[model samples]
Target: MKNIEPKIKKLTADILKDYGQGRTIDKMNAFTSPDMDVVVDILDKLQKILFPGYYRNKNYHFYTAENNLQTLIEDVLFNLTKQISMYLRYLPEYSNADYRTGMERAQEIAMEFLSRIPKIRDLVETSVQAEFDGDPAAFNKDEIIFCYPGMYAIMVFRLAHEFYDLGVPMLPRIMSEYAHGKTGIDIHPGATIGRFFFIDHGTGIVVGETTVIGDNVKVYQGVTIGALSTRGGQNLRSKKRHPTIEDNVTIYSGASILGGETVIGHDSVIGGNTFITMSVPPGSNVSIKSQELHISSKGRPDAEAKDLDQSATWFYTI
Candidate 1:
């Protein structure tokens, strides 16, 4: 091949020039941002703490529960403190301070978060029970805790919510996004979800930020409890954008309950594939009018099948 050293140098110089340009993509000499791998490791350790016996690492030799917990908690605490400190340095209050100051603040927040473990566990237990009671396919509570993606998603959301509540920026959203990557359920850490929340067959579910869900609420797959419109963008930040789901409500699969003002009253059953932007009264069963179906045999003539297809917009009820 012909000499390519000059071409390589030219390409490198061009790429370096792009970096030098005054755009917002450079983090050249700033303090290190939160590491995704470390955040994932924190999440894994938190899982063990949250559900004690459900997820155990075979690599670690466990002599006793107390001994194992003591070790795991220290390891997780060190890493969590470091990660939180890194993110906190970017905040306005911590911006002028040194890394040590951030670490001090992080330690305080970490300790407070750790202290809430018992309450978190209590809420998680209710979630596990919710999954067990709601899903008929669940063999036992243990099975739901171990195998359900909904439980995993909700557990991570609960943990992240604590961080969100404490106002530790970036870490909570990272934790939530990590769980979202593993499970198709996308629950925003900013959402306020109450006790005994169950998510069934939770794939393609989007629980948006500022959504308020009350106790004993169960939602199925392909549900979007989201904002009616996001046209306002940052202008709508910190404002209620999603709907309020009251206690003892069941939102079925493929349901889109949008708008902040839309309140789903208690004891309501929102049927599958239903779209609601308006407030639903208590004990209301909201469903779309069933459409007629013309089932044609596969062996039927092509012309007959084509005729059946002319009745556009097919819908399935749940």
Candidate 2:
């Protein structure tokens, strides 16, 4: 009994040590970190500004309309500038001088980006129209604005893409990744998506960096606009690494269109579950045939009588 008591005490000590270690590790990676929550709050405010009356449920009297929005906008700009400065300070890629210059550049870029909000709002209105027109079950534009994950993803992408264009390092990707985590739509910060774009059931969609998608393009879930391979590191870094999809193209679910040189021409329809690597001409339809499955019953005389050649039975075209 004495030996058992010591063993139990030792096990309890080990468990307690592990618990304490876990708490320490968790503290280091806590979401309550100022950087993380500040960025998240900035995004929340941006969303509220982008889609008024959809996100925040604050009671504003008639007199407070202009003042409230103006205050919120100023707050967003100030917070964003501070966050950008803070992020640049922590990132090891930039030197002290470079960080200062980059922060200045980011400030200018952010101002330009904020200036484009009116245009973005117009684009989002088109997307809302597209959603309402595309889905029969959609009740109203308000529902799409309020509840749709696709709209949220697109909004973040548009904002992040602008930052990416302005040559801000890491922040755009971080912003887009935040949206990706929430919506399951993986739109790269550097992807060039045009106005009036719509992503239907946007989960699992991958728009790679350097992908140039033109106006009025629609992409469904599980579509991968990606690169085929990166043969060399230096060559891959600055070069185009994703497919160029021209205007009025619709890529359905599970379609993987890959390679830098690959271009989907204007007015094309890519069918669901198709794998494409080469260029497609304009006004074309690409699809993959459904695969067939065979089943054989055991302990049946009729099934046994059937000639089942192993090589022939296993092979089938998709």
Candidate 3:
């Protein structure tokens, strides 16, 4: 038992030495961890600011709201500045003379990002309306605002997109991934999405980087707008790699639209399980033609052997 302590310590030290090189993975490229727990808390506070009574799970009033909002804003400003400063330390392109300069820049970026909160909330309100309007199962707008995963994911994307535009690396993706964990919908922060976007049954939905989505777009579960190829890897960086979906488009469940050149024109309805590799013009409704279904039943008499469809139709993702 006494000899086991030295062996365990050496093993732990050896493992740390192996992984701490930071060459194989980008984990330790940054100077320090960017306080993701604080980031999550910041997002929660932002959610409260966005929807006061709904997220707090408590009563809302002007007196309490004023104090809380002030305190929360200040806290977010401080913590976000600290996190940004840490992130700025790692970026070679970002110029910083000293710790003071980095801190100042972080504070400036925080204030600027905070100023856009009202606008973010406004845009998200429109998204909530879109969600309510698009989903037939939705009871009310309140339900959409208060209880929908799609709304949560969209809010994260909208908030994180600002940071992405600011050229703040890592944090934006962290924010997006946080929402992804919660909702199972992965929206890259670099994706350009228009106002009034609604994601119905958001699970398994992925919107890739460079995706340009227009206003009033609705998408269902398991839909993916992704790149056709990534063989070029880092060489193809900063290129348009995803599809462009135009206005008033509804992409149904399990539909995969790939390639940067693939444009889904306005008022398009892409049906379930459809695979699109090329562009479709405006006002087109694209659906899958039913293929032959081979069904079998227990041999009661063998006369009922005609390919009778079963209760569940099999689906394949393209």
Q: How far is candidate 3 from the true structure (C-alpha RMSD, Å)?
A: 9.6
lDDT of 1 by residue, 7-84 (tens): 999999998988997778855654477789998998998999887877776678978999889988998889999989
**Which structure among the candidates has the greatest lDDT?**
1
TM-score of every prediction relative to native = 0.87, 0.76, 0.85
The residue-by-residue lDDT of candidate 2 on 1-318, one tens digit each, is 558988999999997677676554535534322376777888888888887777762655445657878877888888777666655544565436455585685577668778988877887787888777877778888888878889889888877777677666677888889999999999998988877788888899999999999988889999999999866867688789899998888899999999999998777788888788777655556666556222112222333224543223221243
Q: Pairs clashing in candidate 2?
A: none
Candidate 1, lDDT over the whole model: 0.86
lDDT minimum window of 10 residues, candidate 1: 292-301
Query: 2 or 3: which has the higher TM-score?
Result: 3
RMSD of each: 9.6, 11.5, 9.6
Q: Distance from true position, residue 17, model 3, in Å? A: 4.2
Better of 1 and 2 by lDDT: 1
Q: How many residue pairs clash in each candidate?
A: 0, 0, 0
Residues 120-187 of candidate 3 have per-residue lDDT tens digits of 88899889889877788999988887789999999999999998888787889999999999999999
Q: Please rank every candidate by lDDT, starting with the best.
A: 1, 3, 2
Error of model 2, residue 163, in angstroms: 1.4
Backbone steric clashes in candidate 3, count: 0
